[model samples]
Target chain A: MAEAVIEAKGLVKKYGELEAVRGIDLQVAPGEIFGFLGPNGAGKSTTISMLCTLLSPTAGTARVAGIDVVHDPARVRQKIGLVFQDPSLDDQLTGRENLEFHAFIYSVPAEVRRARIDQMLELLQLTDRASSQVRTYSGGMKRRLEIARGMLHEPQILFLDEPTLGLDPQTRRNIWTHLNDLRSRTGITIFMTTHYMDEAEYCDRIAIIDRGQIVALGTPDQLKAMVGGDVVTMTSTQLDAAAEEIEKSFRVTPTRVDGTLRMEVPDGKKFVPRLVRELTVPVDTISLRRPSLDDVFLKLTGRAIRDEEAGDRDRMRQMASRWMGRRR
Target chain B: MSVETATKPMAADLTIPVDTRAASLRAIYIIWYRDILRYWRDRWRLVASLAQPLLFLIVFGSGLSSSLGSGTLFGARGGLSYIQFMYPGIIGMSILFTAIFGAMSIVWDREFGFLKEVLVAPIDRWAVAVGKALGGTTQAMIQGLILLVLAPFVGVKLSVLTVLAIIPLAAVLAFGLASFGVMLASMMKSLQGFQVVMNFLMMPMFFLSGALFPLTGLPGWMTVLTRLDPASYGIDPLRRVVLSDSGLSSAVVDRLGLTINGHVLPIPLEVGVMLAFGVVLLGIAVVMFQRRD
Candidate 1:
């Protein structure tokens, strides 16, 4: 469609000896909602930081709104709105004051600033509480306020790093609805990062990053289709014998994972019954299910996406490096 | 939620194109204005910060006045007393502590996560630093003004003209000192680290400044260090202005005056030094902010 709003070529970020984002390449078209899906420490935030002009890439180049992030970061900053993973709102300021601060810095003209702010507050359903200090708002309200602030400047692309990370499930869904609504109304481009497999379903396209590289990138349905038909999993005490028996009998390899034998077939319903009847080994239990985003992640990354503790540790290491960098 | 609450048409209008220069100026003003507004909202912080200047002016000034024999004659009767001699020092101290600590607001902002809001703005980083410095300067100057009420009790004279003269110098000193604080705070990222810096760095700065005593007759090394301390330059001009109107003897003024190469630093020169100090430190702070936080 339109020329990419955000384009990067082999972008990399290094903190001393550690490479947070090894080498990332991405492109987001105008009006597209793109999501970077990864477990914690997967370089989602790092890549977003480079695109937002908050960090310098160590080994590559990136362009946002056609302005080079490194060559002219100040201009790049003007064209993009960012809602960082961390809580970045000024709690001391009212919700309205917070939006006003963003508007002023982005140089929203005085003539239209008040109207735009009122519109944003009303859009976020914060008009009634706009005058109260931000610290008094609940966590969900704060996230919504941040989203309102991000859209206040009318940037070409909005970057949100883990926008719903710490929110309750209901709040998460509400934010998703608002994002979709904003996209429909303005056709604004959204580039966000999330670990939630379900949330990735909302994006037009998803990039699955593991370690420091994109393991897979496609629409949610397309990625899930890669897993094909249906999945059949069975647990038995003689798992190895059963796996061998099923493979030989059906001519389909069964992979043993977490003490269970899993195999994919065109139709689990047709395959499971025949396998159960034909199998020579006794099975304790068997189940059939459709493939999900989590299963796709598992198949691509070779592990589950529940390593939140790794995420915490990775963040700590990055913060420490940042602090040490400040010293130099 | 009502149907009206559904998302309305948005992102359709003209988003303002930043006039870089004008935006920079606005950035400075809004950031400074925010600091002032926040301080106004927190009354306890304002009242609590007043304690340091008062304790120094009354307790420290009075106790030392008794030990130094009311600062006359090396006790000359009816001459300027020790409390009077250190009055400017107390005001300078007030500005020093308040302005410097005020700059530390950035670190608190960092910890609380609000600093990212400022750091990521499209405007110049210098604007942010300058705005923060101005905010801290205004607050420091106000604290110095608050101590002016205690001047009469300490036996220091104040006319409208005397106060008028003190205001600009104090503001300059506060801006310079606040810039210094902003510079330090920008390099640091933690409040606990700032507490350590306050003790080790701020204590020597106040002590070395002639706010408490004259610089004459100190060890050679100590004299050089005091001369280098930016706080001394700030305290000197204010000292000159306060003792200038007091009719204090030439001897007392000479003892309390800041000197370079044995010549007393003129008021204009002291103000120039302070201005230079503010500019350089704030420049460094701008460069620091330019680096990714």
Candidate 2:
């Protein structure tokens, strides 16, 4: 087994009256891609902030590249590169200048800086746009430039916070391909926080966090096995009542998702016949599929991955209270 | 076959880590250089800073020149033209104004998150502060030099040697004031608060510095207040340097029998005082920066 290059124990961060991160422990091994999977406001950014030395943890300890983050952040920063959720490059500078500026800050030697800049431009396919101002680049190009800049100093570990958050699916896939190639070529450990299940699938292992706590941590296969059954989905004109009847007849949990009835069962194919007969309403369409990461999150959290209402309401109230306090 | 092929490519790809301190300093130089480059590129900003002092020199100095012609008025030495005397004061005033307003860039950086990026870098915190101070002081120094070059055009005679001496003095004052400006920028936290402090503190300091009028023209209390003002101290020695041929001994015996050099000496007390102020303000700014959110 590879040794862990990044480790955290009982890491906690508080923002006055609120506890943003609550005693989360994490370990990321060398040459491994570790994903922090969480919904918005699940303290993923907060944890990354403390680990990256952007914010001082309120309590607990984290070590990146064997250096304690709180006690020796400067050393930790020297070893770990960070690409924040927002692109931090200066719009006034060209892509090459941005990388050069970061290389200088990391104290990269001139010859190496030039070589690395050339290599990264080729790697990111940005040679043509290297001299173009960042503000002129497309979103994907900017993100790729930022990633290249982050790796300019050849840090041992790289932290990418929601790297593909707002990108289109095609762009996200393209970035993922570049990221995978980078890891395989350089053997650099990558720590990423993302809400997208497909993004998490690209990681070797992932930690599912909710409410400032890691609910589960394992490989995607292991996590999918945790749900313990094939997901049987049915589409009916009256999904609500049919789902209710199907749940009553079988000892399976049926969840109403987007005009469809989804239930997990060990023998979905075998149970389909019984389900159709037992259902009071007619099923227009029925299908059995393998469990996905969304199903795993739903099974673990007892709510769908995209539970917009509860999360949005909580976020709105938090924002409103913050606004009121600021006014006061 | 595999071993030889792989080894060659891997060796070519492998890179040794190089020392980065020199690069960091170079980056800081670039940052400072960029500030000057930007100032030159933005002709309007240059024009505004230069025009402000030139207007004061042209209108105020000319208006007061005839009244105080070549004489010992208000304890000034005899044979000094009012334009020559007022020129250094205006230069000092320009330095103070430029230094203080240079801090507005910090506020802009914070709002735009450029400051955050700089803070997150592996460089030393003191380097960030010092780099910013150097950038601001460089801008102010350039403006001061521009005013000096334009001195003859404004009816003030200044030798090249005096101009050379005035550069370092203006730099010291600019850095000192810029350090204070940084402290204010870090403490205020908001643009509105900074604007209020700039108007309240900076404007009063300039007016009370005797940059516009001779310190002796004011009442006894006002003169005492001017003595306590750092800007007043700054302008005194600079004025004496520019108007040195007027037979004025830079040192004066105060009422308390204390001998003080206003500007005649090679190194003026104003430079020392401003240096001390810069150190104190820089110390405070560093502390404030560490504690910033």
- Winning candidate number (TM-score): 1
Residue B287's lDDT in candidate 2:
82
Model 1's alpha-carbon lDDT is 0.86
In terms of lDDT, the poorest run of 10 residues in model 1 chain B is B8-17
Write the residue-wise lDDT of candidate 2 on A1-328 in tens digits.
5668889999998878888888999899999999999787889988998899888888898888878888877778878878877667776677898787777777877678799999999998999999887789988998899899888888899899988866889999999999999999999999999888878999999999988889999999999998767999899888777867776778777887778888889877888888878778998999988898898888888767663453475467555643452232
CAPRI class assigned to model 2 = acceptable
| Chain B structural similarity (TM-score) per candidate | 0.90, 0.80
- Error (Å) of candidate 1 at residue B84 is 1.8
The residue pairs in collision within model 1 are B72-B75, B72-B76, B73-B76
lDDT per residue (tens digit) for residues B89-179 in model 2 = 7888888888877754677666555666677877766666666777888888888777878766755567778777787888888888888
Q: Candidate 1 on A197-287: residue-level lDDT in tens? A: 8899999999999988998989998998988689899999999899888878798888777889888788888998898898989989999
Query: Candidate 1: misplaced stretches above 4 Å?
Result: A13-23, A58-61, A307-328, B1-17, B70-78, B243-255, B291-293
**Candidate 2 Cα misplacement greater than 4 A, ranges:** A15-17, A56-59, A235-240, A258-260, A267-278, A284-289, A307-328, B1-31, B37-44, B57-86, B245-267
